[model samples]
Target: MSVRALVVDPSAPAAVRLGEVPDPVPAPGQVVVEVSHASLNYGDLNDARSGRVPVGAVLGSDAAGVVVRAAADGTGPAVGTRVVALASGAFAERVAIDTGAIAEVPEGLDLAKAVALPVAGVAALRSLRAAGSGPGRTVLITGASGGVGRFAVQLAARAGAHVIASVGSTARGEGLAELGADEVLVGLEGLERPVDVVIDSVGGSQLVAAWHLLAPGGSVQSVGWTSGEPAVFPPYATVGPAKSLTSFVIEGGAGPDLAVLAGLAAEGALTVEIGWQGAWDRFTEAAEALRGRRVSGKAVLEVSREERRAPALLPQG
Candidate 1:
């Protein structure tokens, strides 16, 4: 079966193009999902422009789809269940995903909105958890306007921490305030009080500067390196005496926590800022928007509704 998908052709010098590709089939322990919606992240833009994976590689990591096939073993999703799945190559009409990688969409949640939660949501959850975010703790977040940063701010604040958000521009600063950040600072230099936890998504000199804002026995969770520079730690600094630094990388097995985030979205405790929306044909445009930092929230690529369904095959025991 031929299905429409975003194809990044190596031979074509132009940007990514939407074209028909062969539909994926379910393999053992895997199910073919009919994709409903997919969202863009920084990694997608990098992979599309750099051809890091392959020229024709499908470029999406977060998607909400319907399970069409289940492994015979029934270890994964059954047929006809709505789910939010995390995997690579989600830019296509159908994606064959491992059962373990998928999470059943929470009741009464918009699947399109759910697409924005997995990657950024899980990262925010893990980052806050690593930072020891909780009641009475003061959490500082850098790049509070970006996708991961925005989610971090909301999650940290919901955890009862006093959120101090830092954005590069005043426009973004305004939006961060609505996302529950207690205080919004335009730049790293605006931070006046030391925080118990810091979530640093903007690396480089910013990371170095944020390190100084950590309170004694405070923790900093480093997640992204968007600044194109390495983080530098000073010697015998205040960080040495009372600060702890850690890094968060979102891998598989975060489904349980992601489900919690999905539940929060259902309850309206979490808000997903939609920065840009485009059809599959405008994949390049969406990617460019992300690369230029023009988008404040997650960028989404709308796929065909026909792609949403449960697979026919079941996992074998």
Candidate 2:
């Protein structure tokens, strides 16, 4: 059996298109998921354009759907359970993932909202936690209008940190105050008060600016270099670690973290803002919007029923 999936055609100058491919089968500790909705991340966009994802390889690592096949090993979620997973070929109609890659989507949350929790939501939680944000502390989040940035802002605020949200344009700053941002800056300029911590997603100049504004004993947790440029800092900047800067990628096996985020989202303590919601076939438009920074929050793509409602392969004994 074959399924429809979004693949990168390296031979076609890295074109992204939907193609029919073989169905995914679960390994010993893995289960097969019927993807219903997926979120577009900055990483996926970069991978598609760089042509480094390999020719004919399915793209995307974020997806929320139903598990139709339980692991043969009898471990992990049971069949018919809805989950959000870090499946590499998530852009496809179905994907096989291990227990480490999935978390049950919380009650009262739809698949689309669930899709936002795995990568972007988990990144936000981890980044804020890394900053050690807590009561009476101040945290600044770069690219606050973006997917991870939005989550970081909310999570930081929830942790009792004074949250400062930064965006490329003032227009993007609207309603951020409601999201618990004490301040919203169009740019890093006029930063009268330094922050205790910084969650930087916009690298390059933005990261440089955030680093410069870090308060003594403060730290910056760097993630997502959406600027697509290298960040350079002065040699004197690293003199004596009064301030610390650490870069990290979102690692897998964060299912518990995703579950926490899902609960917060379901309770309205955290908001999952989907800036652009459309059919999966509109992936090109969503990708362009994300790459151009035209989206204020996350862009969610709804896979068609024809894809997600495929017949289950697992047979009842």
Candidate 3:
């Protein structure tokens, strides 16, 4: 049962390695999925370079796969169903996932494209929920050129709010606009207007600066600390205006929200950009590209070309 996988070896000082490993088995309340596609995130970059993830740990978190085996408890998905699962160690040919963490992807959706929907999509939904962005409100999204930011821009706009996006460079301005952002601000120049809600994914000094532009009673959802700096909140200033500051971490049991995202994608209301694609053997290269910021949208690992059609794994009797 050898399966191709990307293994991060801390002992190796140069780069991550991709090869073969034993296929994983499903435990009770879990299902074993044969991965079709997996997406790389910023966390994967940190894990690869610093070896923060244990040696031999697979690096991907979001993936679309087929349920190969169901849990004995009959509580998980059924075998042969095309589904999306959120779990660590997804940079492999197969992964065992708990029932609560998997979602049945809608029909007619591209399995590879669905790989990009889970993490970034959920983050965008939660951020907008926290901000209370809706009709008549103005929402601002920083880092709109990146994966999560792109989803945030679309989700906020779909909710009938005017979206103002901030990009790191002018090269991404047009893409951000195409993703439904009402306005694209390149390099943070001339953005003095106030917004009802601000989704800050870049964090650091930029997050601190964004706080000033939020309207009184507005909320800011801080999801990622990609800037590698501690967020300093001036308590007196934030408290005076009754502003709410919150952070989002996607743990487990986010399937319901993911289902909503899948529905949106099915309805063509949400668009997923496939920034780059590579084979499982090329995962290290993809990781490097993500680390170097050479990829736009989301980069996916095409584990296999085979497609499965059946109900997702369900708990065994």
Candidate 4:
């Protein structure tokens, strides 16, 4: 049997289209989940045409849903459990997710909001931990208006760090201070204080500016490059105090971190801000808004049960 999904279509406006693909058969350690909501990330847009995710393949990373078939190994959630997953090919009516990659959504947490936590939330949590975030440290999060940036700001503040949220414009800096940011700035201008840790998403010249402001022994976690611009360091730029720039990617079973985030959201400790939400059929509209930076936080698509009826064959891009 085939299933309806959003597949990569280079010809389409966002290089994706509503198409069909083969149904996923779960392995012994995998559970089949009927996806109810999926979150969109900036990287997903690049995946469509960057050859990272092949054309015509189902494209997505974050999904929240109910488990229709429990794992044969009895390792993860049982059938009928609501769960969120950070897995491949999640933009579908149903998905086969490995037990290690999923976390059960706590009571009172909406699946649509849980869907927003996997990619951006995990990155923020892990990156902060890796950067040694704690009380007395100063954490500066670049691209503070976007999903990852917003999450980082909250997580860092909760960790007792003095948080500085930097965005592209003053208009984009709204509500960051209320989210626990000690300071909010439009870009990195007029910032002379050294930062103990840096969670940088807006690469390019902004990264260069942030690098110069790093304190001794500070760590710069290069989480993302939404700017899509080059970072050209001047001569002797790297010859300053001992600071490190570490590239980052989510590379392990995310179940534990996802659980922490979901529990926080359930208790109202963590907020999930969804900027754009609509039916899965309107993926093009969502993608366009995300690419244009019109969406503030996360973009979520609601998958309907009626769309599970698959066509005879998958469409080619």
Best by lDDT: 4
Considering TM-score, which of the candidate structures 1 and 2 is the better prediction for this target? 2
Model 3 ranges off by over 4 Å: 11-15, 50-52, 229-239, 304-317
Q: After superposition, how far is residue 303 of candidate 4 from its true place, in Å?
A: 0.9
Query: What are the lDDT scores of the predictions, listed in order?
Result: 0.79, 0.84, 0.80, 0.91
> Candidate 1, residues 159-207: lDDT per residue as tens digits?
8889999888888786787888999888777576788988888889888
Displacement of the residue 213 alpha carbon in candidate 1, Å = 1.1
Error of 2 at 289 (Å): 1.1
Which stretch of 10 consecutive residues in model 4 shows the poorest summed lDDT?
308-317
lDDT for model 1: 0.79
Per-residue accuracy of model 2 over 1-317 as CA lDDT, tens digit each? 89888898754432688788898767788888888898888888778768668778899989988888888888789888989987677898888888887899878988888898777888888887777999999999989999998888888888888999999888988778989999998988789777899999889988887888888899999887878788788887767658888987777687778888888888888888888989888888998888888887899988875544554756633
Q: What C-alpha root-mean-square deviation, in Å, does candidate 4 show against the real structure?
A: 4.0
Q: Please provide, for model 4 over 1-317, each residue's C-alpha lDDT reduced to its tens digit, 9 standing for 90 to 100.
A: 87789999899878999888999888889988888899999889889889899989999999998888888887898777899999999999889899999999999999999999999999999999999998999999999999999999999999999999999888888888989999999988889989999999989999999999999999999999999999999999999668999999999899999999999999999989999999988898999998887888899999864544332222211
Name the weakest run of 10 consecutive residues (lDDT summed) in model 2.
Answer: 308-317
TM-scores for every predicted model:
0.89, 0.94, 0.89, 0.96
